[model samples]
Target chain A: MFASIMYKEWLKIRWTYLGGAVLGVFIVFEIFLNLGQIIEFNKANSVWNYIIFQKYLFYSDFQFLPAFIGLIVGIAQYFPEIQDKRLKLHLHLPMRENNLLLSMVAIGTVLLIIIYSFLLIGLSLVTLIYFPYEILVSLLNTVLPWIVAGFVIYFIAAALFIEIRWARRILIGVIAFAFVSMFYYYMGYDSFNKAIPVFTIIALSLSLLILLSGYRFKRGTK
Target chain B: MLVKTSRNILILFVIFVLAIFVPDFYWKIFEKNIRAPFVLYSPVIHDFIISKFDDKTMVRMDNEGNLLTRDEYEELEPLFFYRQIVMTGKMPDSLDGMEIDIQELRRNNFSYRIKPDAIEEPFIQLYPLLESKSGRAKLEMPDEFIRLQNRCEFINCESNEVVEDLSETFSKAFTDIGFKFPAAKIFGNPTTRKPFDEGYFITDSAGDLFHLKRVKNKPYLKKVNRPNGVNVKYIVVTENERREFYAILVSEASKIYLISYNDYEFINTPIEDYDYRVHELMMRGNILYRSFTFSSDDMIRMVVTDREYNKIDQYDEEWISRENTSAGKFSKMVFPFTLSIIDAKEPFINFYFLFSDTRALIGIFISLIIAVILYLRKKIKLKFIWIDYIVILLTGIFGLIAVLLVRYEE
Candidate 1:
């Protein structure tokens, strides 16, 4: 039953997932072009150059792509199910309501991982060509923090959908705006600002707490 | 219905208010503890001193061990105000052998103190002296030009007797152009290498104690001693203002040899329109190793070598000779602002002034654009309300400004 539900979710969002993968590749390619231009024009020599380039590459685009895509895909994933009362149909199924929500979260997570993986692969290839061997190790270290931030955004979106009913759209929009703005303000310009990361970690932690708390089963018919 | 709606609105408003105010409060607390005003003041003074001195100055050290004076030092006395600010706290125990305590003088709750050590006495003394003398006279003096000589000597002495000895030596060096110099700190050993036939050689002024050998009629570096002393074979000094400086070459025969000052002039050899092979040979030899090359037009090209020159299989020709070719160019561009807010807990008023750089402004612009576009798109679709826009814009502006303040500063 879980397999079928997960498969159904996958089938529903396959096109969006594929589009995200392609977008990831395009973004990585653009980043490579910018990095190459910088290298060519400036003639960078030190290993730190590649590390800094990778840091900016992730800072400029990686977080935005996931949150932007996640909000759009996340809202669309649930909008039809909620509006058509198809979620009510799921209540009649032998599986628990928690399973349905978990399945949706699982599917969204899998898709995001796939897209992010594509970006990583593209970045790796470009970095291999342009940078020295030392840069590969630094780039790997640089991307780890972004990867953590991406997961935080993904899970927060999932939790928000479950908690808010009529105002889910509004809440999601607000959350998305707030999240992206906070990321830009804290990580982008103020990367040296130590508080920004602390705040982000706190926000993610709270979101996770709320998600875990919101997991109780609910009976059908208001 | 109205009351319920107002209550919900009030709750949301409160959350929003707390969100903005809480972070500012936290930043204030953080700033109070971390930002050391004294430490910050030190670098500023250091930079000011270095800039006024033209980055590098040739210190004339007489055989009697006194650094010569420069006229420019006296003219720059007024600029030492920043250094005074750095030395404001509890006085460091020593300052050029003068025993002094900087006790804060308080009258009516106002306190201030200036310890003698706070002012680097050597630099302080030299500043006024340099101002009174002509540049020619300053250059000629053997006691005045030693780089950081007075400060180093002053700080090393333990007893008043030692301090007196240092002071007498310094005063004699200061007054006499040629004093049978006192004992000086020898940077490295002056011993010569092998091959007794290689003529009389003296160690270079730069004081690198490495041994050099001629292989296939070319000087190649080989490691002789490790874990004990550095093995510096070929010493090259290239002056930006002049084409020549003295270098000491150590041959395999443990004999010190002096390469004429003119031999170091290969650094200024105009590479423009020159044979590529000549450039390559100059780069390969210890003559021009790790030196920057400049064209007649002032385009700078820095030659970099890996730890083992063997790691570089091929050199990027365009990268090596391109205009404005120094590696620091990119680093400078990317990190435009060296000022960073050391403490995040400072109040917004205190922190805002710190974001006074072009790079921070650019970051704020990018972040705002992203927030506004996201907020507007959601609003148009009736997916989000206007409040979202307000929250995002405020967060974007404040967050960026805050970040710039905390992270961007050196």
Candidate 2:
């Protein structure tokens, strides 16, 4: 049952996910090219000097890609379900309503994890060519929170758009906005290490908020 | 029951957003930056020089408030701006019968500043240990960085491999000094472009302070004996050319101590109530005297000490936070309560609730009268209209918006 639901979700978002993957790799490729330029053009020892002495960022342009992909995957997955109350057909299946809802969310989440993991691994490989392990670690740590924030935005946006009541939707939206704002607050690299545990808990809990919207939809509260 | 639970959740969300945003909006529109003067002690004049900035123009005055010209101010503050004075050929030869040399002045001058925001901020764990004594005129970057977690291990930068020999030597150095495995905190400037490197001051799991440096090709570890009953909270490494001190150690008790170079000893500075976590510290030192200034958001304290760190004079300045303006006063009257999640001391956003001032009662009374008049206007029965009263009383304008937007539904 879950496989069928996941396939349905994949059918909805496969193109969007592919586009996101292509864009993510392009950004990482751009960072690799830029680093090559810096290392090649500078004098003998200046590349290391600038990197160590100054706060030089390699893949700053890639910071927004995770959020962009998350947004796209979210809209592609849920926008159809909300049209003409097509979600009711999915809910009426032999599977439990909660299972159906959670399975749909899981599909989106797994897709996001796969997409973002590809980006992170590609970034790690690219950074290894010109930079050291220290920078690779720092850059990975810095980008992790932003990526986590991106996925959380997707989860909350799905939950926000599924609700039937405008009043309650706005209320959920305001709360989710506050939650999503936290991930992008721009603390330096590896600073989020301490908050990551707490944020992960919050992000997982947010995955269940779709249940609230389903309940409202069932109640026909519009 | 589901509707009730969901409505309660909605109410809580509305309240949280209103509390955090309303007060923030007030401050955002009414905010102003208050500029304060920089005061420094002049060993040349044996008095304080006030460098006041009024918008774009800067005017200098003596302790007696007499306006001094640029040259006079530069001469008056030779130690503060000694290089500029000497280059401009305005530096006095002697001060109070003590001859002043530019080179000597350069060696002794040092400055330290700590802002409150940096305390709450998180920094990367990986630190580079630059060679403190490279034998060259200039220091160069090391090929590795040390990560202190389960163990203090140095990894080669290029190959992404651990340097076992160097790591073993440094690990053994720490173990010899009774440093417990896995360092708790490591403080180092980590840049070679500074005058010199002081390496890193590492605190082990048992809270013992040890200095680690690569000196003359081998690791030099010095175990610093912390004062009795004092637990160090933060260590600021001072790599001044004079090498008067290795770092400034702030204790959990809010006491300040200087880790001096002579015999690797701790010299107690006469600074009390020095909370490194909350206050910003500005310290300026010259040939004869040092001025230590610490300020929180609302007040500033400037303490002068001689070469021996004896208290010479202390001055205080207290001012109202710009948020206490007329707009702030009006916000108290207009809102029943404001929720704010952001705070200066927190690294991330979270909930903080502030009940409005007693003047908020006026807002409540006005809202109550309006709700009552509406009930009478519609001629609605008591039972159905009761939730409106509850929402109005609890959330003020925020409740009114929620209740009106959603309408009465049960």
Candidate 3:
């Protein structure tokens, strides 16, 4: 039953996921080219100095890609379920309503993790071309919150879309905006290192919020 | 049961967001910018002169609370405003039985400032080990930079490969001096804009201080014997032309010291109750006196000493900080605690909570009353929604707003 549900969710978002993967690669490639050009135009040592002392981020172009992909994948998966009450039909299957709702969120989260992992690996490879292992580690630390924000947004979309009332949906949306903006407050490299664990836990907890919205939907809440 | 848990989580999340944003918004409307006066010691008058902005005008006064004209203030601080004093032809030939030379004054005049943010901010660990004596007119950055991890490794910036020969030579040199591997903290200027290079001052895993420099493509390592019982916290290397001191050191005990060029002696400056984590320390030097000024949010302390580091005079003053002002007092009465994710002292993003005093209980009590009225108006049973009341009692206005927005059905 879980496999069938996963397949159904995957079918709904397969094109969007593939598109996000391509865009992620394209942005990473652009970063690669820009870094090579920067190194060529200036001395390599000065590039390192600029990145180190001046706090320049070589992969800033990839900052918002995950959030954008998360939003789009979220909308792609959930927007259709609400049109013509398609979720009402899906909930009638021979499974627990909470499991049915959570399975959808679980599939979206796993897909986002896959795409985010691919992008991180690509970024690591590009960073290694000019920098050392330490730079790669800091880069990962710096982007961990951004990746978590992707999950947060995806989970919020699941809740917001399935919610039966406009006022509650807007409330969820405003709160989600407030919560997600915290992840993008960039102070410097690895500024989010200490907060990543807290952010990840909060983001993971948000996934269960969809069950409340699903319960409202099941009860025909106005 | 799962739905109820989810709903409670939603309420807690909203409370968290409100706690951070509500106080921030309140401060945005009522915040005040209070500028501290810039105080300088005068050699001629032998008193501290103060200059500050007051009601869109600059006010100059002496420590004795006597107002002075602009020219009079300039004349009083000839050593500090030498250009203005000399331009006005009021520069004295000699103040303390020595001939005044512009060149000497220019060389002796220096200002060094260290803030809590600069001390705690994040930066890449990699540093360029410039050649101290490249014999070139202009200093050039070295082809490689050093990373002091488990061992000293120098990787060429262009090739991104470790120079095994140079790495081993420096690694062996580090071992020869009984320096441990894996440095805990490395401090250096790391710029070619300075007059010279003083390499890096590294603290080993055992907290021993070691100075490493590259002169003529070789390693010069020195294990500094810090004063016993002094644990070094931060070092600001000054590669100045005066050569009087190598760097300024702040110890873990909040004591400040100068690493004098004379046999690497630790000259302790007479500064009392200085916590480097919260204060801004500014050191100014002239030919006759060295002034150490450190200030926190509401107080400023200036200690003037002779060239021998003897205490000459001191100035201390306090003003009401923003949090202590009338608006601040009202805010305390209204907010149980203020939450912030960014702090000026640390680079990491984490929750910084400032819990208000007993006055906040007034706000919490009012918030509890509002929540009770709200629940009664909505016809919600108190027994089924007891947690909401507890949250309101604890978090005050933030919890009231959260529970209201995320209404629970009984």
Q: Which candidate leads in TM-score?
A: 3
**DockQ-based ranking:** 3, 2, 1
The segments of candidate 2 whose C-alpha lies over 4 angstroms from its true place after superposition are: A1-7, A25-61, A82-103, A117-141, A156-182, A194-222, B1-15, B52-75, B83-90, B332-410
Per candidate, native contacts kept equal: 0.00, 0.15, 0.76
> Tens digits of per-residue lDDT for model 2 on B130-241?
8777788898877777777666688665555778988888887777778897788888787766888888898888998888888875888888888798787878899887
Give the Cα-based TM-score of candidate 3 against the true structure.
Answer: 0.98
DockQ of predictions, in order shown: 0.01, 0.26, 0.81
RMSD of each: 25.0, 4.5, 1.3
Cα lDDT tens digits, model 1, A1-222, are 888888777777777767766777778878878766766565333222223322344325554666556655656565555554566676568975555666666777677777777777777787766643334544543454455456556665555544434443354445444534444432222232334454445444433322231331122233
TM-score of the first chain alone, every candidate = 0.70, 0.93, 0.98
Error at B193, model 2, angstroms: 1.1
Considering summed lDDT, which 10 consecutive residues are worst modelled in model 1 chain B?
A: B121-130
Docking class of 1: incorrect
Which model scores highest in DockQ? 3
Q: Could you give the candidate ranking by lDDT, starting with the highest?
A: 3, 2, 1
Report model 1's TM-score to 2 decimal places. Answer: 0.37
Backbone clashes in model 2, listed as residue pairs: B19-B339, B20-B339
lDDT, candidate 1, B1-410, per-residue tens: 22222222323322333344444454454332211111000111121111111224344322233433533322222122323433444333433343333331111011112121211111111110111122332221112111123331221111101234534544443334221223121221111121111211112233323222222222222211222233333332211122122333222222222333342221122223322211212232221112212222222232322212222122112222311333323322222222222223221111122212443345445656765575466445433233434433444444433222211101
For candidate 2, the per-residue lDDT at A1 reads 82
Interface alpha-carbon RMSD, every candidate: 17.2, 4.8, 0.9
